[model samples]
Target: MKSKLNLGLLLVAFVCVLACGPKKENNETETADTTAVSNEPKEFGEADGKKVSLYTLKNSHGVEAHITNYGGIITSLMVPDKTGKLEDVVLGYDNLADYQKDSPYFGALIGRYGNRIAKGKFTLDGEEYTLAVNNGVNTLHGGKKGFDKVVWDAEKITTDEGEGLKLNYVSPDMEEGYPGELKVEVTYVLTDDNSLKIDYTATTDKKTIVNLTNHSYFNLTGGVKGDILGHEVMINADKFVPIDSTLIPEGQLESVDGTPFDFREPTAIGARIGEDNQQLTYGGGYDHCWVLNADGEGMTKAASVYEPKSGRLMEIFTTEPGLQFYSGNFLDGSLTGKGGVAYKYRWGIALETEHYPDSPNQPDFPSVELNPGETYHTSTTYKFSTK
Candidate 1:
């Protein structure tokens, strides 16, 4: 009778295991799912009396990132180099106050209009609006208080591809002299493929202009440690916009043939930056925008940068029509950054993907106008790898 009871109990236990799996296994799976879902952002700072948060994203390959709601800035991006070592490749301040106080837009999101608008004025729909001139005689990066200076609302987002943050902000009408009540949504995703993708969408109640781009000063050899002069660059552009003495576009898409601006091949950034060119003289370095060579942009290769020492390669793929390659000529070692490092001139580079600068003033360039009922959307990805 005892043997019969033991056999019946063993059968019941086998049936339960088959039906419900193992309790330990179920608990382990639940714990993993909970950990991923509960990845909360920490309180970073306060801006305009609103709370600002910073999100930390990581991939299975150990690539980690820290982004803040204030300016949607990427404070740190650590990726593995050829030596299988991780390094922070972007330059940024350690605190929010440094960004607020006369920053160079390091790792921030530029928007409303990413570039200049010529003399701080533009006529849209027969109404001329004058904007605040911050960059000499032009309205730069959506005027004085651009999107880079504002605090946005951010939430963690996950997809089958990877993890990211969805940021939302509504720019009031004429917040920076732009003409609309613009609702903007930006998503920054760190994919498993070691790429950072930025997706932007916006809609305006009234007709307004929008040109958004991330301004990340990448050194590749790690941020602010050395100049990017040794980095090799290739731009998929046959033509580039020539800037005036004040660094505003001269309204011409000049051919890059036989000029230092030509980067059809992988060329060192400092190769011809000091060549006797008038355009180079005006900007003090490679600060102009190049018109991307695309058949009809779905997503095309805009540019690629490679650092030899670290063997870090970054390829820029975007739906935008232009690439602004700023060689960090304006960074003058005036301030200290993360770990008390002073950022000097040409220590970093920005390959900002966007529409042409001063597009409103130049009718020949691509349109940036987002009217009512029209959704403005664009995407840019920076793929990193060791070559």
Candidate 2:
């Protein structure tokens, strides 16, 4: 009888062990499967009369970036630091509705004319042309409907430069009343060296003004939590184009000396933003154009920004003559961003590579006229690295 009791107790202990361990393991397995299912990507909408899909590019070091064919916008850029934590370094929206309706031109390709046109009028080779006036008494960013909204004809291309994707769009004559059928092609090339090269090309059927640029708001602090107040910025410029109260250029190239426009050395963006300066008040922040110190030859370094916290650094190289350093002053707490984060004022920073603002109206400014038999070509690159 004692032997029988000993065997029964042993069996009960075995059963207890199974009940305690395997059952807990089953629960853990179920919870892990639930988490795995939740992390899968959800389906999104279509674009451009084709199978609009999102493409993800990853480097050998596991840095990933997502690009969608819709407007050729960059959805997100994930970079892994020395600690093996990946972060979305660029600002973007969550769904298609936010991007379609109230986008702040985030990660978009702005073209035809990147900035504004005074009075919606300009004289090209002594011929007057009137463009679409969408802003108050002026035209901003190509018009009410610009290239940023249109889905470009895209193609994945390979180049010795790097793995690249090319997008094409044809702006028909009088589409927005600029006077030319412009065929434009923009190439976003990702290099193995962590640089995003944007090359633009265009040809017009008639005489038209053209200036293209990319609007990518960057927050090197992983696009979360930290303001850019601590980031150091420098622009290779000695003179800047100041604007009036309407944020339109007043046809004068002002010196950066003794002004907040000077960025020869690294300075915080908010250092001179609140100063009692006329240009600051007119811009509501730093929205003016800086005449880049280029040799009038090829692509050169225009600007550089370094975020000490994340150790992510961005260098802007472009063939354009000017750069627009926008502090995102108008980004009020109205637009909900990715993961329902409210993008408050100055949430991101835009370093627009283009000609000066209102260059079409300013006679002394660089010519933006694109006529027949002449191709409009411009290139800008944003190279990223961690210090």
- Alpha-carbon error at 161 in model 2, in Å? 3.3
**Candidate 2 segments whose C-alpha is farther than 4 A from its true place:** 1-44, 47-51, 82-84
CA RMSD, predictions in order: 4.7, 7.5
Please report the TM-score between candidate 2 and the true structure. Answer: 0.86
Q: Model 2, residue 323: displacement in angstroms? A: 0.3
Per-residue CA lDDT of model 2 for 1-387, tens digit only, reads: 999999999999999998999899999999999976643333456654555555555555666666666677888888754455778877898766678888978888887789889888887778788888987898888987888888776666668866667788899997787888999998887778878888899999988889999887888888566567677899999999989888999889999999988999999888888899999888788888999999778998999998887888889999999999998888887877887777778878999999998887787998888889999988898888888
The 10-residue segment of model 1 with minimum total lDDT is: 36-45
> Can you write out model 1's per-residue Cα lDDT over 73-138, one digit (the tens) per residue?
999999989988999999988888888886789899998899888998888989998889998889
Q: Least accurate stretch of 10 residues (summed lDDT) in model 2?
A: 38-47
Q: Give the true-structure RMSD of model 2.
A: 7.5
Task: State, as a TM-score between 0 and 1, how close model 1 is to the true structure.
Answer: 0.90
State residue 134's C-alpha deviation in candidate 2, in Å: 2.0
* Alpha-carbon TM-score of each model against the true structure: 0.90, 0.86
